[model samples]
Target: MAGGVAAAVLGAIGGAGAYAYAGEVPRGTSVLGVDIGGKNRSDAIAALHAGLAKQAGKLGNPVAVRLGDRAAEVTPADIDLGVDVEATVTVAIEASPNPIGRLLGSRTVEPVVTLDEGKLHDLLGTALGKDARAMKQPSITFSGTTPKPNYPQPGRGLDAARSADAVRSGWLGGGPVDVPIVEIHPATTKEDVDKLVAEFARPAVSAPVTVTTERGDVTVAPAAIAKSLRLVADKAGRIEPALDAKKLRAALSTPLGAVEVQPKDARVAIVSGKPRVTEGTEGRQVDVTALATDLLAVLPKSDERTVTGKLVAAKPATTAADVAKLGIKERVSTFTTKFTGGLGAPRSQNIVQIAKDVDGTLVKPGAVFSLNGHTGERGYRQGYRDAPVILDGKLVPGVGGGTSQFTTTLFNAAYYAGLEDVHHKPHSYYFDRYPAVIESTIFWPDLDMKFRNNTEYGVVIDTSWTDNSITVSMYSTKVWDSVSTEYSPRRNITSPKVIKLPKGPTCIATNGIPGFTQDAFRVFKKDGKVVEREKFTWTYSAEPRFTCG
Candidate 1:
């Protein structure tokens, strides 16, 4: 009994010692593979820090997550990957809570790893978001000259929540962890896309098409079809093929214009002292929509390779019947202006050319005729050459210089024809070649001799020129018995300024002329009775005569 008493006392003493020691972790206890056995709180936490540092090293190197050829890297340190050191120490303490239990079993305390998923998302976004587009299901494309199609792509997307969970779950475990990426499926599947492609896009681009009309033929080669066709997705997620009309029309515009006959307005002229009109002919035009439809239809089966669609006839803007309704019966009024036959032969040739240009123009009632418009741009193109023209009160060599002779002649004819003068500019200086105040001068673009045909009948102008002379006559039904011009004597005359020229053969000698202001009355008489009388006034500037030094 005494021995048993002694053994019980010894056991009690040993139990107290063990209880004091068991406050610390038991042997073989580790935090993420780092042994923390027999360590104090501070020492165990330091050991956990070392273990986390090792894990960080393993995760720092790039492990790329790839989709097709695209890849993004995940860095553990960038994501704030770390261990919960305090919590890990608490777990170690809990493992050894009871002295008896601590001595009985081995324990391993796993350190909780921490990370910022927002950081991960940011890093990945920059790396991966560049080429991530919503899938265009069953997209049609061209491979060389042939039409090629692709199946619907189940696109890839980043799932931050799932990725964060995975990274957390796998942190303790060692090895490479693949990033979790969500697959974004298209609205249509591969089978549906394939069927639609086969039905529309594939067949449309499979063969060449030819368009034919009575006028000509146009071939739409396979290469053109690839550029012209498009595939679009509908609300129901169906892929449908359609021709890009804008692109197709642009492609065919040049070819269509080449084969088509452009429309022309009817031309009017006086024949045999009466108004004569030439009938306008209809021209061929391609129907764009019809051609597209026919080509789409015949491309699949027709062996002729020839799409048959007749060209539509287009009507002209003016026809022969339109011109005949104008009442251009007889001479309305007539006048002839005479010029000296041997002065400025160059000017005479220009007068003849201008006459021919204005001859066929028909002036409708109340319509104004532009001398510059009828004469067009004058140069070598219209067969005009350099001649004498008055510029800054001096004669200078210029193109279309002699056209003023025709202008005066035409103006007088229209003047007696009872036409209203809309615009006219007289010469700056008085010259024997043109009548003062009543004559008109012409330049291109800015200045013109315009007159409105006020009478109900259309007027046909007739002009002809001889060597060193020009005469313009108006031919129309007689609106007045007679028309005559009365002129005022030259007044306000200024002495001509003399200009000395440098030694040159190109210099021209001119006679000094005085500038004057004059007035004229154009009187229209019907059966010996006074009718309309219009007064015209002019102010001329003195011109300096040039003398070669």
Candidate 2:
């Protein structure tokens, strides 16, 4: 009985000792490189904050996150990736539960981290904006004569949740945190593109398709089909076929001309040196869009491809009312430039041809007229003959040489009509025949003269030519009562250089002209008062004298 009593007392004493030891922290305990052994809960927390202050400060700043080769910085406060000091100490205290184990061994506790997924996600989006790549879907475009396909490509984006967790665990280490990147796949795969090409794009251009309209049947060739057909990806990246109705109409215009009643646009025709408006007429037009849709339905078929189209009444693009609204009734300005070439001369013929092409052109209000845009290449095919043209400071026989004479006349007419000059370049050498510092030259598409009709009324251009001169007149509502020019005295005059060349078909003799700088001021008058004055300046290069041996 005495031994039993002694055993009970010893057990009670041991239990009391365990209760005292558990009140304080375990010995040899460390948390985030901070030692807090044999201390209470409050003391352990204090030690953790004091010991981790420097490391926590480093983490509080910006932490660099690397996404492949691209890197961005993230502030701990911005993303909510940080440690909970009180919670960390509690975890360290609970790490060693057994009384004997806590007394005998050392424990290293991980810092408790706090991370808000919403904040982290937004922060990552801003930080890694450039590094994030978007996926591209497959598509086929009809930009060229044939269809060209753009293949699908994969993209990359950050794995936000995983990266945030990584930062929470690894940020305390004070180095660049590696972000996880995931591949983003496009909805339209490469296999889908291959299928589209084989199923539609390739077969659509394999043969010609005939479309029958109310007028007659028009055949669409394979090249035309290739130009009109387009394989595009929709919003969901699904490949679909489409047709360009405008291009299809252009291809079938010639064949359908015989069967269709075409509408005539309103135009101005010069009569007795006066403006006459010709009324437009409406006609039955083919429904090209519906016709193209029917053609697209049978483009993939190899045999018996034909469809019927409907005809509808269509109005002219420009009506008689449109022309009447322009208020073009009387002549506003006229200019004439005389040439030395007589009748049947190549230069005279060129001047007449260009004048005919530009005759009766109606320039709308606020519209710009381009000489080169109207008359493209003036090669032999365009009926321009070989004429003596100025080249390399000498006279050489070139096609469309004297067309510049027409351009100069048009420029002067536009100038006197109070039209705005968009672009014009004077001749390389001074020519007594042309008004000094006011004339312009043309060299195919490069050297062009352009003018804009800036008035509220449309301008009608009329051209008339004689054997030795060409005249251009503009008919519109006159803005100014009269327009005159004031010239500046010629300055910086230089003598011409005499050039000697062997006698051949290519060389022509010429008396060289002197170079000089001059300026002209356009005076616009309204009610006998000068309303506005615009200045124009130019420098002319001396034409070298070419002597034939």
User: What does candidate 1's lDDT look like per residue over 1-549, in tens digits?
Assistant: 999999999999798667557436566687767888767888877877777677766656664555335666677678886677888788777756456545555667666767898887667656667555445555667675555657776666666776677666665566545565576566777777667556655666667777777767776777677777766566334665566767776777767776788777665565665556778889887776667666666555536556775578878876767656766566655445565545456676787788888876667777889988777898878889888877666677888877887888888778877788899998887778677788888888777999998877666776655565566666556777888888878788888888998867557779888888989999889889988778999988877878878
Per-model CA lDDT versus the true structure? 0.72, 0.84
Query: What C-alpha lDDT, on a 0 to 100 scale, does residue 201 get in candidate 2?
Result: 79
lDDT computed for candidate 1: 0.72
Weakest ten-residue segment in model 2 by summed lDDT: 15-24
Candidate 2 overall lDDT versus native: 0.84
For model 1, state the Cα shift of residue 192 in Å. 32
* TM-score for candidate 2, residues paired by index: 0.70
Model 2, 442-505: lDDT tens per residue? Answer: 9987899999999999899999988899999999999999998999999999898988899899
For model 1, the stretches where C-alpha displacement exceeds 4 angstroms are 1-318, 337-345
Instruction: Give the C-alpha miss distance for residue 228 in model 1, angstroms.
Output: 22
